[model samples]
Target: MPNRYLGRRIGKYRVTRLLGTGACSWVYEAVDQDLEIPVALKILRPEFAGQEQAETRFRREAATAARLRHPNIVYVRDVGQVDGTAFVAMELHPLTLGRRLALVGSLPETECVRLGIGIAAALAVAHASRVIHRDIKPDNILLSQSGDAVVADFGLARALPSGSFPSDTNTVEGTPHYFSPEQARGRELDHRSDLYSLGATLYRAATGRLPFEGDDWYTIARAHVETPPSSPRAHAPALTPQFEALLLRLLAKDPADRVPSAVALVDALAALPSAPAHAATLPRLGSRTVEAFRPQVPGRFHRLLTAAVFGLVAVLAGWMAWGRTSSGSSAAPSPRPTSIDSTGNPTARGGAASGSGIPLASSGPPRDSTRDTTRHRPIPAPVRRVRLDLSAPDSAQLYVDNRLVAVGRWRGEVPFAPRLTVRAVVPDAPATCHTALHDTVLTRVTPGQRLVIDLPVRGCAVVRYRVEPRDARVSFLSLDGGNTLETRADSAVSFSLPTGRYLMRISAPRCITFSDTIVVRTSGNASPLPRKLFCS
Candidate 1:
């Protein structure tokens, strides 16, 4: 059920409806009766009201945002409480950048630069306030109907000491893909950390893809700490060298190498070589603006395709070289950090085969040197493009070995790799409801070959229910009298089905058979079927 106070007044504002909810707080669209203005009222969740840490973090967001009032920053308007439930009211924004991206596959270059400048301007003010937005992903940025973007959500921001800034590396607090290498290692962080995340956001805006792809958090986090991403041109060809250079520098594995500060980044972006009022003419991929964000789960071995990968990351390392710039200085390639290189580490031997389940480095440990020394190691093979035609519903995204390659019915070239794994997801479906509806393939693509695959979508509904006895035998059947699927009923069950009426019957030890009929609806709007039907 939605939280109470949706229509009730809290302090001077009347909560109209929920804007969004997170693990810590709930944001509501409200009207400030005293001021006669629409405001975003962010309230600490009632469930977490008594927790000291949650309360501190909630209040800390207000304390931090209140001090950084700039045009591009979503500043707090009021801080008050009602009946021991504290809330902060700020300027209302209709949508978030992450949501906006989902609606449009990627932003035009001009719009991307404009948003970048706005976010950098906001960060400059926050940096001046001695605060660093540790979490600076698309989800935290809000956009207005006027095409203006504002940086919001300071819940992960931390206050810095005067003249010195360092962060504890033990607890990695930010999103894995956008997190800096230092942040991934739980090391000290300065303002540059936010810039690195900005580059990630820009990369997505320019390319409609994430800089890194992984099945789980640890794999992505490890890549942030170790692997270096390819240039922006590798994803979006129309982006200028100057623009790509700045983004690469911002994403430099070393914080010292990133754009010095938000102010510097704004200046650099302003002077971009292709600083036209619009983007260049080029073919863009994808069907809609979207973020391929896979929520971070605790780093555990994913059982989904355990038989899939062994020599996972042997990319044909052909990095796009940065040529001479307007300033006549060519961009230099950033050397891979020695600290992250596991080639010489004692633990590098067959660490991936140990069943740790964590994603191993793309390049596994080197083969035996003595045996290779006897014969010349043949030149490394070039990445061969294999043409593939894939079909799916609109707004569906396809990934090859975690790298987003296509959307919808796409015919494109894919880098040749053995044991290639393709996974497709429909953005509109809820995670639980569409779990079985995903399309996945495990095979090898022959170079210079063309292939087609009709991505099968498992159209189903998830009905969650519980039984009186944990060990009750349950049988699931389709109303069309299709074959039944039987299993023991545990705490709760969630199943997807085709559009139809379905029946579930549970038979306990000595009790009579209990049953319920559920109606499966459309694909989108996958609200979980609340398990309220208790069978006794």
Candidate 2:
């Protein structure tokens, strides 16, 4: 079926093709006729136009997000309504962070840092405006052609009326997998909630897994409220200590434990590269006990002892090299305070030689046996064995390294191979509604470390609902009858559905049946479904 909106003109923008469809609205690749430039036009689904509060909130918050005017935020071009359709126009990007992650599981530590900095900076701007982006997930973060990370879809953002930080809302919103603990419990929220969400997003980017997962939204939400997230390093062992520390701090269950504000978050991210490389717990290998050492600058006492020992060894070695020629070569000058450069070269600093003023060798004294011994040691390879727990949709074909491993849900151990590839494909459906849906994780594992790889028949998107007449009954049936939902009235409910068209019908004893079709896609949040159902 073709999109009816394509080739249609709304306000000054002409819809080109459907970019994506979500619970609340449909985003289209469009051109601004006035400016003759491309833009992404998000139009409220016809069924939701009657939702005045949702519409007002969408426009109000979108305008607030547009006013942010930050380099890392998606630039909004215009906001208005034509006839009965309300739409927002924004700068179009080639892809989203979610899409990139699907194509390539996890990103390099350096790249994650770069993207994190931009996202934090943008959050800083939004926070300054007293605007809270209630939803900060992978889908809402866009990636420009220039590779810059830009935050999109402030559809869930709300600007607080007062200057006091925390605000109260009766509804529990946001994607389940990325919800903050407070958000999960429907408690008062502040900027810290957004920080926690950002942490979850980065956790996924760095580990190729959600900080918490469950069979459903309620389960995932419960996990956020009660479970301690697994350390990011447990999944991606190659992450730097600094990166892991920052992520852990961001993911702290208590809001107070998170970075104070986006400004502080910016500082934390900026310091990642220069932060000292402290002790890091390396992932366990097969059955070998892991070994780790804290690499720190020695204390004054230790430094003095180390210098005395190295000085004695160096003097002896030099004396051995030139003992015959120079009879009275004054004792080799005491070692000076040394500093290690970026390239690992020890450079002399502080005071010069004390006892032997005789012009000393500039080539630095002869190396000692201790120095050569420690520098030439080789690191051992991890033992070749692994354990895995694979979860996929029923009847889905599971493959390891392109070889058939199992069909449907299978939990079993597999042998370790360099560059392990695990994939799951459903017989007829797409893995995810929008993307090709097969999942791939490129990670090194150990027999003691169990890797849980989950593949789905199709990825689900969230749509919020609110029905009127507390007694009214609301339900949804997909065009193919594969998905059916029965939801409550007058409250926020998360309706998870795969990509497809569904018929929505609402009924009350004395009211006429209100029926409409909803298109569910991989982006956007549609909420408070139809503020009130018309009664006849």
User: Of the candidates shown, which would achieve the greatest lDDT relative to the real structure?
Assistant: 2
TM-score, one value per model: 0.52, 0.52
The RMSD of every model to the true structure, in order and in angstroms, is: 22.6, 19.4
Lowest-scoring 10 consecutive residues by lDDT in candidate 2?
285-294
Mark the regions of model 1 whose C-alpha exceeds 4 Å error after superposition: 274-536
Question: What is residue 390's positional error in candidate 2, in angstroms?
Answer: 43
- Give the alpha carbon lDDT tens digit for every residue of 63-111 in model 1: 8888876777887998877877789999999699998899898887778
lDDT per model, in order? 0.69, 0.72
Q: How would you encode candidate 2's per-residue C-alpha lDDT over 312-411 as one tens digit per residue?
A: 7679878887875475467554555555445434456657655322232368765333332224444345556667778876656676654456778777
Clashes of 1: 14
Q: Supply the global lDDT for candidate 2.
A: 0.72
Error of 2 at 74 (Å): 1.5
Instruction: Report the lDDT of model 2 for residue 517.
Output: 90
